[model samples]
Target: MNIIFEESPKEVADSATGFDLFQDRSIVAIKVNDELRDLSHKLSDGDTVIGVSIDSDEGLSILRHSAAHLMAQAVQEIFDPAKLGIGPPIKDGFYFDFDVEEPFKPEDLKKIEKRMKELVGKSQRFVRREVSDEEARELMKNEPYKLELIGLKSADVGEGAAEVGAGTLSVYENINPDGTIAWMDLCRGPHLPNSRTVGKSFSLLRSAAAYWRGNENNKQLQRIYGTAWPTQEQHDAHLERLEEAAKRDHRKLGVDLDLFSFPEEIGSGLAVFHPKGGVIRRVMEDYSRKRHEEAGYEFVYSPHITKSNLFEISGHLQWYSDGMFPPMKLDAEYADDGTLKRQGQDYYLKPMNCPFHILIFRSRQRSYRELPLRMFEFGSVYRYEKSGVLHGLTRVRGMTQDDAHLFVSNEQLESELTNVLDFVLGLLRDYGLNDFYLELSTRDPENPKFVGSDELWERATSTLESVASASGLQLVPDPGGAAFYGPKISVQARDAIGRTWQMSTIQLDLNLPERFDLEYVGSDGERHRPIMIHRALFGSIERFFGVLTEHYAGHFPPWLAPVQVVGVPIADEFGDYLQKFADELRSHGVRIEVDHSDNRMQKKIRDHTMAKVPFILLAGARDQEAGTVSFRYRDGSQENDISLADARIKILKAINDKTQV
Candidate 1:
């Protein structure tokens, strides 16, 4: 018999098992062919095997999922009324939901953790056994959630298909040394060998209320989150990263810095930027516009609402109607008898800017000379984001997109797309983001939602793939992830904390132009359809603002700071002198302010520093007499009594150069 291990094939005994070959304890599981199997799985003839180590991503998921089951057992032991729910592993951790009578508080989490520690210390063995639906229901009759799952399994729908559709249901039971059962749960699992393996390197994060299956209409249950790692050092590192992420959470920093707020009156997912936040947004938009103007993009404008026919022509009504808000029936008419005279038209808030841009292209005749025509707009779009998915700024319903559409001839498609990629990367670099990679989203063959012929899609997809590959950056394939009308190359950027954010997208659309009957006259004097390239560099202003806030940890560079320079007088007497200096800076188009509040000098400095001001200019006795101001940087570094001439030059140069301090 031929057995493959570590990518090498050799003859071995058919009776050989994963545990016999993979003697290293770090090898948690075995991949037989393409399927993950337990280490105790026996090897068959002509089998390809690979080791799954504990430190790998898949290994960590299994470890965390096993921890989730152990935690569920502990919850049941500590809380008599607890009922089991689905437990799934997520990025960096796992969470399990419970249908308890009351929510778990902070103190309750401590009790659960204590019980978990005791369970781990028991060194119990985990025994996996398969049972019929009737037997499983009878065994777990007391647990309503489990019984409901058994019923779902019988019907083979929802999560039940995964729970038992494999022809049988499996339950994992913790066994005592005396061959007695401790605890068990219904799950489709490839768990760690024992509860003891889910060791001390795990911590319960927090508990929150979540609707079952993510449907708000379903019953809400309490969910507990936890993370598992291979070592204590790794666990500590994960915790430290979580702390840093919390500190940089944009929602908290937004309020702490007086940036933005979500008003209840304005409704959920709608934001109102305060004066400070408005300044930051204005700076961002202005800089982007300047860059676009230099890049030869013609600025365009469109209305907020339009007749539903536009979306219908763009095929958005068929493929994307669910994401759009319901339409408003307008232009109603009535006769003297109060009977309907004429039917009304349905108008919808524009969920996208592409259809409108297409209308502009079709409004007039075009020659090949204008084939590479680019149209730009800061178009605000609205999406019906469910309340459960909406977050601060990042996931808002209303957002202005820094969108552009480029039309090019078929022969010029590849070159124009290459240029667009370069333009996207360069503009993003100007915004202080350098780390990036490209994801090529292509059409799914099985889904009929994608419009256009295979030939058109292939040409569009290959052109984008070639352009993205030629950029010499990593390209990840996203199967079945393309827009219904075209394929897109989305730019994935890494933030300061090593988190990736979808910053920009450049899509190659061939269907919309054809659907809209957009054309240009070629040198051959023949009318030919143009290829439309849709690009959104910022994705949305609200989301970009959130990303920037968290990326910079609310300490924006001098160029983008809401208040570039703040004038702080050491004494009340020097207020006049500081105000004069602030006037000079303000005249230079700098965002400057003089603190005239009744707070003490140190208190004023503290207040401005907490606001994350880039520069704090202090004027005192000798400095005011010397006609110089002291410079205080965000990092608490200082330069005293710099000449006014040099100070202006230094500050102006930093702002112009976009320096971070």
Candidate 2:
């Protein structure tokens, strides 16, 4: 029979399967007609097929999904009555949810892992079988969550889509070496060929409480998180990275360095910076302000709350109301008779700063001369983030966005976008994030949430694409990731440990201006709608702060360090001498401190080093007599007998150059 295999037409046996076509062991599954299918799937004439390598992203997901099924089987074997929920492969790992009689303990995870290893050793084959909806319901009658997923086959089941979607239901039977079905699950999968291929590279990390399908209103199930890799070496490397990531966790560093806190009394997702963190924030903001001013951005301010009518005009109320906090009804006046009262208006805490900037632009008529007017604000906006998703500074309810809005004529949109991209990259580089690529977030035509006509969206998307392409950076397409009103180019930055974070977003907006009736006079003396561009360089101060903290692992550069220098004396007699030197450094705008506590000099050095102080100055009677101080760095390297004049020059130069010491 004739078929297209890996994009080339070839002749194969009529009964050929994907497993028979791809001999490489690494090719775990096959994509038949663009749909992922098991290697055992029989090929039909004229069918197109491609192999999926075990190390590829799709292959890893399939491997992890198979591992998840293994884990679920193990769980059911040990914890008899454990009902299964969704098990999907995430970025670097997989998690399975279970409705168990009790929460899973660490010991339970160990037992589960042991059983999974035994199952892997048994070399069970994964066999897929298609079933009708009623048949699936009957098979999963004892499994309440599975039955629910079957019922939700035609609806949006969120993560449960991995199990049962709006298609034919299928069950994967884990068959033993003796050709008997050992365990099974209702899943739409392209899983690994056998349990042995899952190998010993998988691990169960931890377990926690999770809602079924991630809905807070649903019953909470126990979720066991795990990681799986094709090879042991890769698995080991991932575990090491996880350990390093834990050590660099910003939330922990926040407490250890006394930088910030999320006080429960103030509620979740709101952070209060300590004095040291405030100092760092101030320096960050000050430098950003200087850069914005140099880039011809006008600083503006707006109230925290605005009437709902403003957002309604900007289309935010209609499209983004879910993210917005509930409005406050205000300004109603009632009669003493408690009869009729004036109608009150709803005032919402601003979820974004663009609409306010739009109002600023609309406050006065403009001409072509002011075409590329830029407005910037360190605007504090509030979002009603769900409690389940509320994390540290990275995911907060209240944040200060380094937001900028540019109003330019349609002819200047591409140039302005290019300039904005350059400015964003340069500013982010100044803050120590140099590695970046651009992601183009275009509208999903099928999604009704996006505004604007097809012509406008195409123009804006193509314009932004041209600008991004001109920058000569790798551009990735994020289909359906755009805001409701516009398409955007988001800068993805890789940190020290090679983790990517979305740093800045430059959005080209055509709908908002039209919605708000914003217009400017052109050279032809006709009123023309100006295209609005939304840009956030830092995304948010709190989020960037957290990113920087983790990127540096709390060892901030000398310029951005909270306490740049600390002085330690070998003995009490030398205390005044070190203090005198600190005073001299402080006069030059350095953040310097002298340790005057009763602790030993070694303890002081250790304490300041742990605090990530860039420079620790030490003075002894001998050094004092020599008119020199000892230099101690965070890495515990030391240089003794450096003259005070030379030391001051070196310290000042590091801070001025923004160099890491």
Candidate 3:
């Protein structure tokens, strides 16, 4: 058997064959075909090993990881620091933590970044050396955190795991060509050959205070964040995207538009919609209700707060208590005190609508006739999100979900899932989002946090995969991304600006059914478990509204516009004509307004345009005499002297077709 070792000069094994050594030391990531594994994993013949460089995404991660090391090294060089903390690679970036004299300032960041660049230019070589655990502890004497890491490493390599043979634990020293070592880090690395390989595609982002290892009770350390890319162009493009993202920030837009606000007295993550915002929300919900009704869906409602026992049976209380609002306490008399007491006394604000929907389904004994029961609700849920993590409507503590659950037989699972996916895709398309991708989130066999048996998980996951395949969806699999109860198919939609947002999800759950004891009588006359498919086309109404606002730049489509049309009169003499025209449009269920606030025609037109009203109907004595009204659109297109009826027809058609004007 061949035993793999990272950066080892020679391979030691029970029985060895011809050893094939990698030629280049710049291999940042070593993967076996599609699977990414740590570089220390063993390899055998016929293994297709792909070497990652500084140009690939994985390569950038490795570079960023090394850059984090460089940051740590630089901080150590400048400040005779107190304690070290963990530094790891994150999405598009890396971060390192340190206990310092005070919070790091912007100027200090500039100096640290400059020092990092200098170290990169020096092209320090990384040399790996193996040492025993006792020796490692002795070497890392100054770092108490390192000593703790050493202990964890010892535990990981202890007992039954030792049968795999204890591989050499090593540290890498950054050395100069003159044979003097620049600096070193205790690591188990297959790092890039030199500091220069980290490339110029790196930048220090920001600093934040974090617990030493993410535990709140632990001492806080200042974390410095940085981003790395494969090339200068990619880096610049990313930075530009970040700038655009900042400009498109919904919080800023919400304030500027006066759509929503969160007062300090009102608390965080709970926004109060302004009149304009309420108007917009009303229009959106009305449209959704109309469409859903047309599609044969029945709306239902449930209480915002439920008893603690309801969630206890649903397994949410045990697993998701951290994200939930603290349970309301009961008075001593209300509490169970040895004497026989009525149950179901504790209360909780609902975090999800699935359990309530399931309860609705279980309310009656179901049969084969109602094989695929689809129930929908625009249900509002409250999740106590940490204040630090809350950001605008997208990440809110309280929001309404366009949620639904399908109770289908095992035989109907595939077709039902397909239909749900198609419906979700169609809904997103109606909202002008055509580009989308699908992800199949499956359970990790090694992870015990997930509920249900392996057989049930396999069946649920396989059914979802089949449905996705049949739907011809280009699917990607995300292991360990499944919900605690079951697997799911998530839909990610890309907007006009090429920004992707997770909008829809279709999850197949067997665990919840088992937990809730949900079943249906099958054709064979035996009670069988009904596969529960939890779906939410629009993850959250508030979040989707925020996304749509940014997607269209607040220029909503005619059907969804808070005000579809605004009537403008050149002078008070044409006020009657303007009101008459607005009334005609409003009669057809259109949101039309007549400008009678003494604002000029020009100012009215500008106001309507700024508010993103689709069409502006301008009336003047000349147009009124000719039996016409001047029609203009937000995009500055004018249809001068158009008949009022003709203008109304065009606007009605646009609204009916749900077209952006």
Candidate 4:
């Protein structure tokens, strides 16, 4: 019989399965008729065959999934009667959850890894079996989570969704050479062919307590996370990257550098910046304001709360109500006889700044000369983020966004968007994030949430696509990821360790103007609707501060550093000289401090160095007499006995240039 295969057409000698179709060891699974299938899947004439290479995404997922089974088998060997939960492959790694007697310790991971190594060397075969629901219930009766998963197939469920989503239940058994089953687990798997295929490049990173199916209200299970690479070189690279990331973790550096803290008194997802952190934040905002002012932007301020009618007119009440805080009823009046005199109105904490900007645009009638009315604000918006998703600074409930909106005529949309892109990229480069690519989020035709005519949608999307492409950056498409009012182009930027973060966004809107009935008189003496372009450069000031903290590993650029210079006197006798220099620098708007404690000069240097000070100035008796100060850089290099004037020039140049020390 003839077959259409991915690489080449071929004929098989026997009535065969996918295993017979491709004998390459790297071919871990098969895609039969465009659907992923196990190696043991039976194939017939007229069927299409595509090999799943072990290094490809689908193949890696299969390998990791099979590795998860090996981990489960290992847990069964070392741990006493461990009950199975779900084992699935995640991005860059895999995890297996188990209902063990206790939380896994560091030693437990070592023991399980050792057993996994032994099992991988066994070259065990994975035998697949299909069973009726009754038989599956009987087989998994010992595992309550498995039975619960089985019941969830009809009622909607979680971890086991992968197990029963295909309309049937299947089990994979780790078979020994003697044809007896060593272990078994329920899965819908297109896993690696055998245990030997999962080589020695896998490592169980760590273990933690996780709620079953990620539901906090459910029972917590012990989950072990592990990563597998195609080669040892790749594994080592990943481990090195992990090390760098841990060193740059913003939360750790924040505390060590005395930047910011999340206090319980202020509630979860709310943070208070310390004096030092506030200094950095103020510098960031100051620079941003200067840049926007130079770019022809008008600064605007809006109240933190507004009547719900504004959101209702903007359609945010219909589209984004889920992310908005519940309303506050205010302004109700009562009579002395207990009869209601006036009705209360719903006032909501503003979750966005666009509606207020729209009001500003509509407040007065204007002509085409004011077409691109750029309005900027450091708008503080509140979001109702779930407690489970609250992260340090990056994900917060209260954030101040460097938000702006441009009201441009429809004819000026393209050039206005082009200029906005240029402005956004240039400003971000100032913050030291130079790596970027554009992600175009277009409307999903199948979804009704997006409100716009096809002509308007196509025009807006094409304008953004051309602008992004013209910027000479790669563009990735995100289908169905746009806001309800319009499509957007989000900038994805890479940090020092190559992890990408969504930094800024440029959204072209047509629906909101119509929803709010906004208009302006055009050159032809007729009323025409204006286009709205929403842009958020920092995404939020708090999130950007956190990213920069990690990007520089807390050694911020001199201009943005909280404490730019610290003076360390060799002894109490030299304090006056250093204090004079500190005062001079302070007069020049530099943040400088002179250490006059009884502690030795070396101790003061150590303290300032620990704070990540950009420059440490030293004044010893000899240097003070010679009218020079020693310059100790953050990296511990020193320039001995530099003249005071020359040292001031170099420090000022570094700060003015915004160069990293």
Model 4 lDDT tens row, 243-285: 9898888889989988899999989888899999999999999
lDDT assessment of candidate 4: 0.89
TM-score of each: 0.86, 0.86, 0.78, 0.84
Which ranges in model 3 have alpha carbons more than 4 Å from their true place?
Answer: 1-69, 82-90, 117-180, 186-202, 211-220, 228-237, 264-266, 327-344, 567-579, 594-606, 616-646
Give the worst 10-residue stretch by lDDT in candidate 1: 156-165
In order, the Cα lDDT scores of the candidates are 0.87, 0.93, 0.79, 0.89
The collision pairs in model 3 are none
Ranking by lDDT: 2, 4, 1, 3
lDDT value, residue 132 of candidate 4: 79
Q: How much is the lDDT of residue 645 in candidate 4?
A: 94
The candidate with the higher TM-score, 2 or 3, is: 2
Tell me the spans in candidate 1 whose CA falls farther than 4 Å from its real position.
1-53, 76-86, 97-111, 127-172, 184-190, 207-223, 231-233, 341-345, 596-598, 625-627
Top TM-score: which candidate number? 2
**Better TM-score candidate (1, 2):** 2
Q: Write the per-residue lDDT of candidate 2 for residues 1-661, one digit (tens) a residue.
A: 9889989999999999998897799999999999999999999999999999999999999999999999999999999799999998987889999999999999999999999999999999999999998999988999999998888884777765779756799999999999999999999997899999899898999999998878889899999999999999999999999999999999999999999999999999999999989999999999999999999999999999999999998877887799999999998878999765897899999999988999889899899999799999999999999898988999999999999999998899988999999999998898899899999999999999888899999999999999999999999999999988889999999999999999999998868888889999999999999999999989999999999999999999999999999999999889999889889899999999999999999899999999999999999988999999999999989999999999999999999989899
Please tell me which predicted candidate would have the highest lDDT against the true structure. Answer: 2
